[model samples]
Target: MAATNFVRGSVLKCSFPYVDRPSRPGPHPHYCLFVDSFEIRDRIYYAVCYGTSRLDEPLLENHNGAIFSVDSSLIKGSPMSMRVTHFVCSHVAVIPDRWVYRNFQARLDFIRPEGRKGDRLRERMYDQFVLLEPLMEYEALIAVNYVRKTGRPGLPGETTLR
Candidate 1:
């Protein structure tokens, strides 16, 4: 695959392999936020925090200082919309560039708001991935801090492309 550049704060849709259910037929599709990227021995790697809509049950208790929620309104051009989407900062994953290029679906982009200089920014749009409005500067800062404090590095699921 050719070299592709992804910016921080970009939201990506990827096929995330199930960590607990290796017997499952295939990987499950999921939305994740692009946080950081680096190159190791000429191979690129991405660090992302996966987002989930399961606000109740087992995942609910996981929402504490490290989780942040994005409302549907903040997300545009998605085929489907959940009432709210939560990203788990502690559930960080570092995946190979090959896997990311192969299983990639869509990504989020920023849209600048119109009107006066002080006017709030408008919702953003993207081509394939769900178009998500960029998080406010403060929100991004909080997320970064949380991820830095709690993020555990690992490829928690299948690492190779099947």
Candidate 2:
């Protein structure tokens, strides 16, 4: 579509995690958010649109809807909050389970070595699942096959994400 289609009012950047691309068409004029909320798609996607000229931009920010509050976790050890990147469609699409697994697995290097790697896995799985989970049901089945059968267990129904 077009940015004018949805952002009729203003360019409010949410706190969603965005990936940096190498480069793109000069002044492609894309919106980046500082907040995290996938549901915002229903309201904002109309204004955002792109294709191959997509400028290698993050297209969609990777946010897993963190479980803990940044303020609550900021005391002894942990930081404020966590950032989870879900490699799923920004709008909607029929995605395969393997695709979801592959998507996240590609982002493993992106994961920071924090104290709780398990927590990060759950966050990544949840975020990715939120976008692809409802569209398909092979996640659990594929996960099992990837783990027990493959001799490599993953986080719940999530792939190893490696």
Candidate 3:
């Protein structure tokens, strides 16, 4: 699919940067929701909220649904909230075609109200609209398999070395 197809309320997974210390080392691939977009000249960027899966945090599991949230901080010591946390909706990025992975394992449609809070965050995160890569079958398989067996996508710090 074209990057244009990724409209508001789209749920996705990518190598999202840290909220506070975005450049610092941490998780590579994080689940995110598409909030809003803007165009700077001819390029576009999407604002997204990086997700968390800290064991000590509260969680909301919408297994059958396409979207969900957790209660943990994206920043290490931040106070816990009712929504997916410890994390922040602070990414303005253009997902390249090579990095796009189609996750047939999960497909979601989040309209207004259902994802109102998240949409607001996304709008706040970015003001530029840009194109992104389409999903790759192979990458989707890796993610799907992991979610199928583990009930979640693999996070940073988890060894892929077998």
Candidate 4:
């Protein structure tokens, strides 16, 4: 089947589109995908971090290009839900550590609220990361409910959502 516009359970690879901001910006606005999943040893690996290392590469190897924002009002609601989970697999015994993967995972997890650290599928992951930017609609996929409930009414770096 062809990819759906808003896919549920299936992770999407998307990027930030360049917008004309009043101030002069970089040659191009940097882009990052919503998230991705990799399958190894019958288990799936999901990642949302930028790269192997801040030093290795700011961007990862398989990253697909950006997904520009679409107006939510343009489309009516549907029964389905598209989920985004961000987590790093903790090191397990017997296997040597994957330094790059673990490092970025720790960075993303650090953004999680103190009480809710550990595990990806848990609702706590939803709370801490999603509410980080209450008004950031596009990135809101990860924590729409947490934001609707407790978000302080503003987008990241902006004063108020309104």
Structural similarity to truth (TM-score) of each candidate: 0.55, 0.20, 0.37, 0.21
- Candidate 4 stretches with Cα past 4 Å from truth are 1-4, 7-11, 15-121, 138-162
| Residues forming the 10-long window of minimal summed lDDT in candidate 1 | 124-133
Give a tens-digit lDDT track for model 3, residues 1-162.
Answer: 225556543555656544343323234665555444433334443344444554232222221111233323221222323345322232233333233344411222223334335665433322211112112122233333333454332222231210
Which candidate has the top score in TM-score?
1
Q: Which wins on lDDT, candidate 1 or candidate 2? A: 1
Best by lDDT: 1
True-structure lDDT of candidate 2:
0.24
Error of 2 at 94 (Å): 22
Q: Candidate 2, which ten residues in sequence have the lowest lDDT sum?
A: 98-107
lDDT per residue (tens digit) for residues 27-123 in model 4: 3222122232333344332222211112212122212222112121211232112222221111000110121122111112223345235544334
Clashing residue pairs, backbone N/CA/C < 3 A, model 4: 15-66, 15-67, 153-161, 154-161
lDDT of 1 by residue, 111-154 (tens): 32331134233232221123222332323344334334434223
Of the two candidates 1 and 3, the one with more favorable TM-score, higher being better, is 1
Clashes of 2: 9
